[model samples]
Target chain A: MQRSRLGDLTAFNQLVERYQGPVYNLALRMLSYEAAAEDVTQEVFLSAYRALGQYREGSFKAWLLTITANACRDLLRKRKRRQETSLEEMVETSGDRSVSPSPTPEEYTLRREVQREIQQALNHLSHDHRLAVLLVNLQGLDYGEAARAMGVSLGTLKSRLSRGRAQLREHLLTARGTREP
Target chain B: MFRRRSEPIRHQRVRELLSSYLDAQASERERELVERHVATCEACRRYQEELRDTVQAVRGLPQVTPPRTFTLAQAPRQRMAWALPSWGTPLATATAAALFAVLILGEVTGLIGSPVAHPTAMPSSEALSLKALVQPEAAPEPTPAASDALESLAVQDETPPAATQELSRSSADTSPPPPEEAAQPPLQVPLLPWLQGALGLLAVASGAWWLRRRRAIR
Candidate 1:
């Protein structure tokens, strides 16, 4: 981290390597659009590099996730203001998965289906609630870290997470029921 | 009857706790309460199971590979830091100052536009006659030769206004010019003022732009 702060590209690259997956995944789940998520992930790292001076002693992952969360919020707000988010446009553009193929075709197909449902469920949430769940459960951040990333109190974070989880569970089950029938 | 009424409240509280409980984030007391409640309450247990499954499903999703590595090719930020280089504002300020100086110098030297009105240039005697003649706002009827002489006196040297006034008197005494001759148009207005005004505006605009850019960069 010191080296990266000193403007070491290799050190920063290592940080990017270690954290890109979580950042990209968070963005993807938050946005439910592959291209937009990629764009946000790139933007997050650029800002992280610029803002490294502002980072005090804390969890670097949480700091990076905070940047990711904020960027996602800004993009979502902009998208909303422009009235540019259409369900059909999102579905059409978001289905192109560049993730490396899984070991088995059947497993990959099933996982992709499930992941799509999860992404759709996440999209159905408010930005705060989706971020809360993504940080705590999906990104594996603890309650305190997730709270810090979301800039909310632990109680508020937990409330958002609980609400988010309940909503997500409902959506997934509904989708499953419809799919099966 | 009280147990039945409190049952639904307890169920709601336990359901709220179920999400945190699955993450092992509940307090020890709350954890114990939720565990005991879920153990006996079929509805709370089912809700916990569903929430747990949802969290697990989210966690289990495969990591999406980043489409490309994000290590900036070059320090675009460093480039941005240098975007308005250290010398930029200084250069802009210097340029604006220079332009301002040029404008002031041009005005003082009468190079930019017609010289400021020279009220005291005419001699006292000539001034009385000139003022009397101009009082009626009638154009002077100096002959063509007199007009030519006035132009020459005005242009040939940086003569004080008194000398030109004397010249006009001598010419007026020699031959009062025809009204037709005196009906010539007044001196042409110089375009230099417009040019100088534009330059001044450019200087101000450049300074403003530099200040704005500097603030944004900071």
Candidate 2:
């Protein structure tokens, strides 16, 4: 990112080509709506472009994801302003419409159940906690990487992730067998 | 939360280090220390299991590739931006050129009469006298009178008064005049353009920045 900001278009392109897929996937996981996720992905990259001059020599992906998390938060805030929500709000949209790879019947059931539980639990979390949880848990970021991606200190990241995971665990446990697989 | 240990050791730092420990990122010495402590600490061991489980649950989420037809691959390539204000940006480069031209013209026609471009520069007494006569402007006062005058000027506009009406108005103007000292606003000569050409360039550059910001918002 630093190289790109220093008048290296090739370096910027290299970053895009390298991280586009994973970033899109992260957005997809966090947002659940393909179109919204795609929009967030674009917003993430656009934000990175504007902030490229501030890039330090470190993990580029972490910075990119932090911006992506911010974009998702903005979208969520916009959604809140509409006084609307997912299907429960009767907003006329279905959830989990973007699961990848054709799943077998059994796999589909488990995936759907997991998806619904996770998404609902995610909605229940505070924005920062959800972001930390998503990056660390769903995106396979270690605490350090998650901290970098969240623009938080490692301790803060761990606290949020642990609290988030505990909440998700509680939510999942409360929903035990309530969702048919 | 305070539980005394038979073998006293640091605890909060160790708990915080659990984040790094779970990720296998702790230094060898730190890792060894944490592992040894965990051996005697049931609470810490359970805490580590919980973190491990949470990590697993998150990792288990389906990596849903967006429905292929709904890819953001169509997302417009974000073009690199400049910090130039659109209207003011051109004024910068043009400013340099224009100022350069003005400076050159002033130098070229200093005392000599250039027939075509500067036939008017030959009046020595005129140039020196105008230079002498131009006085610096003082700052304007912020008074109710000026505001009221501006307001009155705005309000009583464009109606032709009848003769009897004018007579009535003139008759109503019998009040004594307020002090003249309060009426005039001081002249304010802006020193911005002459401050620094480089600063003007910088301002143009800032305008370019503002312009890009506006563009980005759009």
- Candidate 1 clashes between residue pairs 3 or more apart in a chain or in different chains: B143-B177
State, as a TM-score between 0 and 1, how close model 1 is to the true structure: 0.62
RMSD of each: 13.3, 15.3
Chain B of candidate 2 achieves a TM-score of 0.36
Q: Per-residue alpha-carbon lDDT of model 1 for B83-153, expressed as tens digits?
A: 45457678889999999998887667765565333344324665556544432344445557656756676
Give the residue spans of candidate 2 off by over 4 A: A1-17, A46-56, A86-104, A177-181, B1-20, B25-50, B68-81, B84-218
In model 2, pairs of residues that clash are B83-B208, B83-B209, B84-B208, B84-B209, B85-B207, B85-B208
lDDT of 2 by residue, B1-218 (tens): 97865443556556666766776767899799789988988877786776576567667666654443222333234454544344544566576566556545644754212212223332354433332222112323324544454345435655523422332232234332234422433332333434546555655665666465433332
Per-model interface RMSD values are 4.6, 5.8
Chain B TM-score list for all models:
0.35, 0.36
TM-score, second chain, candidate 1: 0.35
DockQ for each model: 0.32, 0.22
Question: What value of lDDT does candidate 2 attain over all alpha carbons?
Answer: 0.60
